[model samples]
Target chain A: MCELLGMSANTPTDLCFSFTGLTQRGGNTGPHKDGWGVAFYEGKGVRLFHDPQPSCSSPIAELVQSYPIKSKTAICHIRQANVGEICLANTHPFVRERWGRYWVFAHNGQIANFSRQPGPCEPVGDTDSENIFCDLMNRIHHTLPRDAMPEQLAAVLVELAEEYAAQGVFNCLLSNGQWLFTYCSTKLASITRRAPFGPAQLKDADVTVDFEAETTPNDVVSIIATEPLTSDEAWDVYQPGEWKLWECGEVIASGKRQR
Target chain B: MCELLGMSANTPTDLCFSFTGLTQRGGNTGPHKDGWGVAFYEGKGVRLFHDPQPSCSSPIAELVQSYPIKSKTAICHIRQANVGEICLANTHPFVRERWGRYWVFAHNGQIANFSRQPGPCEPVGDTDSENIFCDLMNRIHHTLPRDAMPEQLAAVLVELAEEYAAQGVFNCLLSNGQWLFTYCSTKLASITRRAPFGPAQLKDADVTVDFEAETTPNDVVSIIATEPLTSDEAWDVYQPGEWKLWECGEVIASGKRQR
Candidate 1:
């Protein structure tokens, strides 16, 4: 399995602290040293970087650790190959164009005997995750309007996620330069930050930060991950078979279990 | 890159609705079809599944979509190869034993020059993402105390994540069967849901659901993603160089930006 990291904030923020800690996991702390990638959202645009190398020792990873790229939204991944070969084309945090906007996705699971016919959106590699993404695009193109409401689109997405969960593991993160949609089937967790910031420590590295000093009282930042990256802060656990829609660092809608 | 889908709720919920919508993206609407995986957290334990096939056509994905897996915290992913070969070892939602519990992760993005050196926790696959995960484990073992607080861990994790972000993209999701920590360097967004549930639809599929009918007044659910999956709903965006801690479907603490 892989690792996932994401952030949504009310203010433009730099991910320097969290990035540093997560980098250690790339090669220093954790066991998923396959590959790594990350994407940042900046005012309706996205900036992405990917490498077929471990983040612990990668020069690029080092550079990211030192640089402070500011944005409103971000997504990152570290891979553990389960389906595709170790190559640049098979890295996580895949990006695509949809409705004239950039969409990004990443995964940390596998589907059993999953296959799909070619579609308008094609995978650059042979990973099943990419194939699934393309298939979703095809379906989207064939279904809702390009400018549908978030609620409408979310309903359909929930339906599709439920269908996939029925088949096998379907843990995933997806974005379109706007909202972050998260769904879990097994082991996913998240944390959100608002007023009354506090201190935090990294479980993977020897470092700490006092969010109270860096954030405004009105700021709201939310994060979702497969696991907790820090050790001191309190994090909320997502219930199984649940999904939430996040907008501007707040959840607007969600799905419930059918009894 | 990989795709992530998560669901959170105030009450125990089934992911049948959103899973159906997200599964289509695995092979039909999106490009992260390399493989798929999911974990359903039932209380403290988790039910997980993985497969190295496109989710659209994978029997496993189909089963997940059809099955009504219920839990409070869940994580799912679909991969698009960028570092490791197409094999089961390269699949995501990687799990590990930590603090006498299971930790899970899913990632999106890549790091350059990550495979030069092997860390204490080596990558099971060739993907740089896996190597990074191993490195993180190694760092945790070396840096943090066995019974460190979540906030302390978050601080160190933020420092490490910042370092990695300087090198390249470092957005990610991580969990320790308790809380989820997420960091964003780029392209991360999210939404939180509580009372006033309404109808929602999918941008990629022709499906819709009325949350008001399916949820109670006390329901609170949150989601984080690489992008906004829906078209109608308003999704919050994450600022670059930011991280958040989540617990019980709510935001807790946040990081400061140094960029």
Candidate 2:
């Protein structure tokens, strides 16, 4: 299985610390290393960095860890290649433009026997994850109105997630720069850091960062991952069929469905 | 105005040498200091690197110059920002997937008062270049069949390029990994290097490269840019209304029209 990471912040914030922890799992602490990619949402624009090499040794990953590219919402994935070959096209997270906005998506788990009809949003690579992402985009393009709000969009997303989860695991993180929508079919966890931010130690690497020193009191930052990245932080684990819509580092709407 | 760079090769080749020269014009040698982006096509997959910062001093540009990411086709742009603001969203070359293939595009000239009807393929940023790109995609999506060959696509592209050129400047480089199609409304130049390659000196920077030492005899590499990147090489300048379709570093079809 692949590992997923996401972040939502009230202010533009960097994912250097969390990303460093996740990169360690990509090839060092864990074996989830076939390729890795990250998408950082800067306004309506997204900066994507994809490397087919293992994250642990990728020069691109090193640059990502060292550079402080601030973003309001970001999605990242470290792949272990259960379905697709190791190539730049098959690397997650995948991005597609919809409704004059960029939608970035990253999937962690697999969907057995997944198939979909070709649509406007076609997959350039032969990955089940990308196939489903294109499927979701096609559904949204055909069903949803152009000006659909987050709540209305989430309703459709939740419905699709439930159906996808029934087929197999469907844990995913999606964002359109404005909001982040995460769904959990098997494993997912998140932590929100606000005013009383404290120093946190990484579970995967010998790295620690004092959130208090880097963040302001009013700054709110939330991080979501397939597993909790920090050792000390109290992460909220998601139930099997849970979905949440996040904006400005807060969960605006959330629900759990029994699969 | 912006500086455009594109490459088409019979085999996988790195743009490090050419890119280094173009980047110098991003700020140090020219006025195009707004933003810069590059897309390297590895099969159907295109690895993109975008930065709103000026390429001459951008850290990401440094990495691109140093890393040898081999690709058969590539498109790059360094913007001066006339129709759009200097932001990540407006950076080029822009990318979208069509017919299960990634289409990468970069524009050098401006399109004044460019507008388009919204379609499935939309622009995430508000730029005249991106607006025209979406319009082109929409036209191809609606008019052309999914299985249309390169020639059929080029027929449609040449028509649209002529229409857009009538309004304002429309020098562009577009590729779908398989073939590269370039249209020149005002300024464009190209050079193809093969077996008997000699040493070349950069026009923009103090950099010299011995292509004879680096390339194989069978390798045919073609480079397209707004102007000749090297001082020593003789570049073929495009006429005002000229278009060419390139594959395997060779111009398979080319034509010129009087506007």
Model 2, DockQ value? 0.83
Interface RMSD of the predictions, in order shown? 20.3, 0.8
TM-score of chain A of each: 0.95, 0.98
Candidate 2 wrong stretches, greater than 4 Å: none
- Residue-level lDDT tens digits of model 1 in A1-259: 7888787777877777887777777767887788888887765445555667788887656656766666677888888888888765577787655554557788767787777655445665667776677677667767779787889988877777777777777777788767887878666777888878889998888888898998899888888888887898888887778888887788878886584
lDDT of 2 by residue, B47-104 (tens): 9999999999999999999989999999999999998788999999998888899888
Where's the lowest-lDDT run of ten residues in candidate 2 chain B? Answer: B111-120
Q: Pick the candidate with the highest TM-score.
A: 2
iRMSD computed for candidate 1? 20.3
Where model 1 places Cα greater than 4 Å from the true spot, the runs are: B1-259
lDDT of 2 by residue, A4-36 (tens): 999999999999999999999888998988999
lDDT per model vs. reference: 0.73, 0.92
- The deviation in Å at residue B7 for candidate 2 is 0.2
The best candidate by lDDT is: 2
